[model samples]
Target: METNEPNDGHAGNPFTQVPIEITISVGRARPLVRELLRLKRDAVLPLDRRVDDPVELYVGDKLIARGELTELEGDATGQLAVRLTEVADLRDGL
Candidate 1:
């Protein structure tokens, strides 16, 4: 889903047009430093997610929502994208 920029003067200066980093978390793993160092090309470190599971969308370290991974349709880059499924409540703080 897309969010429209606030145009009313009520939404002021601090929230400028600057972009924020958005990270998609496929899953997590706890690999030791030794194990990580041993990893080289094609060494698959399997994440805690299955192929069909929904991934998390995070801003900074907070989980603001979740989404499903999808292919970028009609894009030559063949890049991946996410379609948001759910948005977390700000008061609940994830």
Candidate 2:
């Protein structure tokens, strides 16, 4: 009943210090060269997803999870964020 006990055995685990990169793929686009060249400042190349669609998360090239896009307000940094909706299995991640 006391699972809250601390375990120092993993304190030196190298993986705990290692950092991994996660990428989010919203959607893809395929535009002609002429169409691309015609674009100017403030141009919009619409992606292939809706506003409520979840984006795919990837570690390197392999997809690891899916999340919904979210905006952070009143932060002054104008940064965007994601909220995970579905995560891959631990075995698949490994």
Candidate 3:
């Protein structure tokens, strides 16, 4: 049976216009309780990954993509940005 539902895919979906928040995970750090408590101002906490490691992008707890950290040039100089290296297929939803 013919229906009135739009056939234009997400372009016709109202929710597609909604905004979402993405979380970027650079790395993780594990420290003993005593070490955590010992943290003071200016204390350096080492992470498990190096600066060149690919960072993960997540929507809530689900990872959506991986990318490299980069600094914007020109007018937005010094602003941090992510250059996506890998992206998950989200056709089946998050």
User: Against the unseen true structure, what C-alpha lDDT does each candidate score?
Assistant: 0.85, 0.84, 0.93
Pairs that collide in candidate 1 are none
Residue-by-residue lDDT tens digits, candidate 1, 31-89: 99999999999898988899889999889988899999888867445788899999998
- Off-target runs (Cα >4 Å) in candidate 1 are 1-16, 90-94
Q: List residue ranges in candidate 3 displaced over 4 A.
A: 1-8
Arranged by TM-score with the best first, the candidates are: 3, 2, 1
lDDT of 3 by residue, 7-66 (tens): 656555789779999999999999999999999999999999999999999999999999
| Model 1 alpha-carbon miss at residue 53, Å | 0.6
Worst 10-residue lDDT window for candidate 3 reads: 3-12
Mind giving the per-residue lDDT tens digits that candidate 2 earns over 1-91? 4447486566657886689898889998788999999999999998899888999999888878899988877854567798999988856
Q: Which scores greater on lDDT, model 1 or model 3?
A: 3
TM-score of each: 0.73, 0.74, 0.86
Q: Supply candidate 1's per-residue lDDT for 13.
A: 70
54, model 1: CA deviation in Å? 0.8
